[model samples]
Target: MQEFELINRYFKGRGISRRDVNLGIGDDCALVTVPQNSQLAVTTDTMVCGVHFFEDMSPRALGHRAIAVNLSDLAAMGAEPAWVSVALTLPHADVQWLEEFTAGMHEIAEYFNVQIIGGDTTQGPLTVTVCAKGTVPEGKAITRSGAKTGDWIYVTGPLGDAGLAVEARKQHLDIDPEWLKKLTHKLEYPTPRVAAGQVLRGYASAAIDISDGLLADLEHILEMSQVGATIQADKIPTTEAFRQSIEGEAKWPYILAYGDDYELLYTVPENHKAMLDNKLNQYGIDAVCIGQIRGGEGKIDVFDGEHKLDISAMGFEHFAEDEAC
Candidate 1:
């Protein structure tokens, strides 16, 4: 299929139709309106065929993930997602694949009320890049540099299930069919904590979405805020399938360093702890406090009860010598 025809049929005029988008797809430059008293939050992510996902991955899931990850970044900044532009590269236009892919993209975009503005489609090796935009009240966007000593650390939900899914796929480990299904779903269709992020704007001192592993992403906050932390290893949340499948030294990387779980990792000050709890509970958000910030310069100490465990692995880095995920 031709590029313009492909976009016109599958992407343009689909998904959520937002009033803020003055001009959407088919235009040379899409126009959008940023709300008054708000700042525009923008983020972009690129996923390649082999490097980011298996070539055989579902087109629908890839479409969902492409949008979800970008939204996750906006969510980290406590921004409400508004619009996205998707640039797609493909070997050829497969009709069924495009249908499933656009369906996935539109489904999530509709859920978040995001409109697809404009982007380019070209013939090449498979790759998908999405640039997402959102809005946050002026001076109300959460950031890594806002963390403070004495702030409580929290995560919106469990971690390591996605890591486990990746490991299982790579190692071909013998996993139960049902458990594998659940783990694989975590890796594919991740839920961005959009509402919880908005709720955290007034309460959280610092916030980040766990796209990279908890330790790796938390380090960003510590380095930016110039504060240290002590994380209770046992308090780190995990799924039942993850706990049942891996144990001991084998489990540490997935739990602490492996990436792809898109939950939120945030911090709240002592005085606002009760208020944060009440607010999260009221919104039915399941957040867990795992540690506390301390006075230091970008250090994180992990403890399993009284024992200080030696952990050296950081999260996934694209160019790191030893990449875990």
Candidate 2:
């Protein structure tokens, strides 16, 4: 089927008036109206087979994640997702795979109220690219540049677990039934903190999603905000679920460098420290103050009390086919 006509079929099924869509489907671009007094937040992300995922990965989860990752970007900016355009590339159009993919995509879109508005399709190696749009109150979208010198840094959930899960899958590590099943799913299907992002709107000084690893990604926030911080490795949440997945010696690699954990990392000024519990209460999520931002020249200090772990400051660089261990 022709890509434009397929898109036309999608719009036809929706049954909504075209007035809501000033332009859609076929054209140089698609246009939509954002009502006055709203801020528009748009994010685009791409995932490649083998690099971002593996051949054994579920078609459904891939579709869900293809959009979920983009939505997480919107959440980092404190935006409520409203629309998404999926630009999918496929080696061949397998109807069954497409159906499962769309099902997965719509599941999260409906759950988060994001509409499948418009995008492009192409023929290539399998890659899912999504550009999601969201809305926030005018001037209220959280940015990575707002942290103050005295603010405290925070992360939404356990770190390193997803990274550990990935390594487990790569190495085909065998472990207790209960533990192996849990970690495998974490790697295959990540949960992004959409609710926590909504609640964090008013409280956070600066925020970003940890798509990259902690050290690399967090350094971005500190750089933009002109601040520094001491991140306690001990304070970073770790669980038996994570611990059981790894042997003790290789734990540091998973904790420090593996990427694809979709949790949110934010900074809060000292005044809002007391409101941490209240801030996260509505979302039923725990917000941990992992570190504090300071006035030092832009450098992130990671420590385990007194010992500092020597690690690179960046996460997985997309074009680096040769990975440094």
Candidate 3:
């Protein structure tokens, strides 16, 4: 199929309609209307075969994950997702693959009320890049710089499951079959906490999504906020499945340093705890307080019960020496 034909067949006119979008697809550049009192939040993420996922992995899941990762950014900033543009690279145009891929992409877009605006398709090694756009009320968007000393840190859901899935996929871990299925789902179809983010506006002192691992991602908040944190080892939330699948001490790497969880890690002031709890309850989100912000500049102290723990490895590094092809 021709490029335009493929686009029209699979991607054009897909996703939830938004009155704010003046033009989408078809044209050289798509146009969108941001509300008068809101700021646009834009993010882009790219997924390459082998590096990001196995080359033989499902195209449908890849489609979902490509946009989901970008949406997680908007979620962290407390923005409502609206529009997206996708660029696709493939060695050959496979109609069946494209169909399933677009189906997965549009499923999440419809769920999140995001529209596919415009994009490009071309020949190359398979890769998918999506740029997502969202909006937040003026001056109300959560950011990494807003955390203050005494604020409590919280995560929207359990961590490590997705990372565990990656390790299992690599044959690095011997995980249970049932647990592997659950972990694989977590890795492939991460739920962007859009509602929690929207609810957290004006309530969370600082916010970030755990794309890189709790330790590394939290450091972004600490550095931006010019503060440190004290996190209790036991306070970090992980699923019972994760705890049961991996034995003692071995689980810490997945929970703390392994990446790809894509859950929200945020902070709330001591005074906002009550309201924050109410919001989380209203949203039916499982969240746990993991630590408290402290006075030091960008340092994180971790403790297990009363003994301080050593934390040297942070998480996945895309540009690390070992990561190079």
**Sequence-dependent TM-score of model 3:** 0.95
Q: What are the TM-scores, per candidate, against the unseen true structure?
A: 0.95, 0.88, 0.95
Residue pairs in collision within model 1:
none
**Model 3, which residues run further than 4 Å from truth?**
1-5, 314-325
* Candidate 1, 127-182: lDDT as tens digits: 99999999999999999999999999999999989888887887777888788889
lDDT winner, 1 or 2: 1
Q: Between the candidate structures 2 and 3, which one is better when assessed by TM-score?
A: 3
Residue lDDT tens for model 3, 1-325: 3753565658776667788789888888999999999999999999888788777678889889999999999999999999999998888887888889899999999999899988898877787899999999999999999999999999999999988888777655777898888888889998889899999998999999998888989999999999999998788888877886887777887888877878899999999998998979987997899899999998999887888878886555332233422
Q: Could you give the candidate ranking by lDDT, starting with the highest?
A: 1, 3, 2
For all candidates, the clash counts are 0, 0, 0
**How close is each model in CA RMSD to the real structure?**
2.6, 3.5, 2.1
Q: Cα lDDT for residue 271, model 1?
A: 95
lDDT for model 1 comes to 0.88
